[model samples]
Target: MKKRWLCLFVENEVGVLARITGLFSAKAYNLNSLTVGTTQDETASRVTISLFSDDQLFEQIKKQLNRMVEVFKVIDYTDIDIYRKEIMFLKILKCTENDRTFLFQFSEVYGIRILDFNKDSVLIESIKAEEENNLMLQLLYKRLDNPVEIVRGGSVAVEAV
Candidate 1:
């Protein structure tokens, strides 16, 4: 199986998302990530979905998606031109003089922003998923006295060419 990303342009209507998701579920296709929001054009919305499936199944998915009434367009971004990014946040263990120094160094290197902070934890946000994971790993290596938690947002994408 291969990972694939699709950007679906659909009519702004109720039940559209549910219908689309239902189709995937009925077909036994697992959606890795899905993000939907209104597009600049008020009449339409864009849904970005990531899934792992074979080439034949993916083509069938696309064909079925197009048959839906609310669907305007379905673009297979994995094969076409696109730029993608995933967002993530981590709540690190309690801060200390040493932890603060490590935070500063890691944040500076990865361009992470401090979303929230307290004596017990610091929430750091990053747009790059891999970078965020790497930062979390590095912080864990230092071993703070407190525990840490990670939260990730879905991937977003746009055509690059």
Candidate 2:
């Protein structure tokens, strides 16, 4: 199965998000990543979803979404050029002075930012693709000796204009 991307334009109303997610759960279709936000019109919201599925299943998924009354449009982004990014925050606790210095340098090498730091802890932020974030998380887990905390937001994407 290959990864797929889809964007849905739907009415901005209560229970819409739940009903959409519920459909996925009831059908046993796995959602890799999902994000929803209101559009400039305010009456509608854009829902960006990613999943791993075969071509046939992906087509079925699109048809099902289109059948929903709340959905205004369903755009398949799987074969399109788009800009996508996920936000991640990684905090390292119990850091030493040396570790803090090392982290600052490390952030410069990677595209990560040193968001905040104290004598004992440092917070790093990264806004990048999901695969890149995953690799960074793995590297941090392997390299950092201090306790760590992570917060990740679902990916958002926009098609190339």
Candidate 3:
């Protein structure tokens, strides 16, 4: 099995997101990430979903998605090379002075920005854009003693890879 990104264009309706997600849940399909946003046309929206499946299963899912009433189009980016991005926010506790210094340097290397900082902890953000892999995120996770809290945005992609 391989990871695949499916970009679906659908009507921006009240229950569209639930209907789309329900399909995967009912079928017990494993979904890695899901992100939805309004498109240039206010009546339509773009949903970027990530999942792991083989070719056969992927084909079935695409067919089902195409059958939905609200679905305008479905693009499976498995074969095509597309640009991708994921944004992450990390909060590291202020346990020691050394940690702060180290994290500052780490941020500099990755070009991540410090969103906010206080006596208890620091909040940082990392935006991975036009990237090929998750090496930066992996390194961040391993380097931080362990973040007090972490929040990662869903992956979004566009343009040709």
Candidate 4:
């Protein structure tokens, strides 16, 4: 199935989120990720949601969303133009005197900053979510001999067209 990202503009009111999510549940659509926050316009809020489905079903969902009284705008970012990004943090196995230089070199190449460090692990932050995935893959292949943890933030999107 194809993944679609959408930005929904809706009125700021109680149960607004529940009503929106209900529509998807009633249709048996699985939501991959959802983030809702107040927009600069105080009267309205923006919701960013991602889901996987076919074109036809997605169209039906869009139409139903429009019928909701709270929905002000439903922008299918996957259609016209959009930018989507995610965030992740990597916790590498603690640094050793022997591996400190190697860690620094790797971090420099990837432009990753150390968010926290201890003898047993180091926390690195990457703004580019895809890059983090690639980095993890590379580390696995290289057998860095270090433990790692990843914390991922869901995808956020903005309309471009």
By TM-score, who's the top model here? 2
- TM-score of each model, paired residue for residue: 0.87, 0.95, 0.91, 0.81
lDDT of 1 by residue, 6-68 (tens): 999999888999999999999898999898999999989999999989999999999999999
Higher-TM-score candidate of 1 and 2 = 2
- Per-residue CA lDDT of model 3 for 35-83, tens digit only, reads 9999999999999999999999999999999999999999988779888
Clashes of each: 0, 0, 0, 2
Superposed Cα deviation of residue 151, candidate 3 (Å): 0.4
Best by lDDT: 2
Pairs with steric clashes in candidate 2: none
For model 2 the local lDDT of residue 92 reads: 95
Candidate 1's TM-score: 0.87
lDDT of 2 by residue, 29-111 (tens): 99999999999999999999999999999999999999999999999999999999999999999999988998898898887
* Weakest 10 consecutive residues of candidate 2 by summed lDDT: 136-145
Q: On residues 29-83, what C-alpha lDDT tens digit does candidate 4 reach at each position?
A: 9998887889999989999889999999999988999999999998888766776
Winner on TM-score between 2 and 4 is: 2
What 10-residue stretch in candidate 3 is worst by lDDT? 129-138
Candidate 2's TM-score reads 0.95
Every model's Cα RMSD, please? 2.3, 1.1, 2.1, 2.7
Candidate 3 versus truth, CA RMSD in Å, comes to 2.1
What CA RMSD would candidate 2 show? 1.1
Off by over 4 Å in 4: 93-101, 129-142
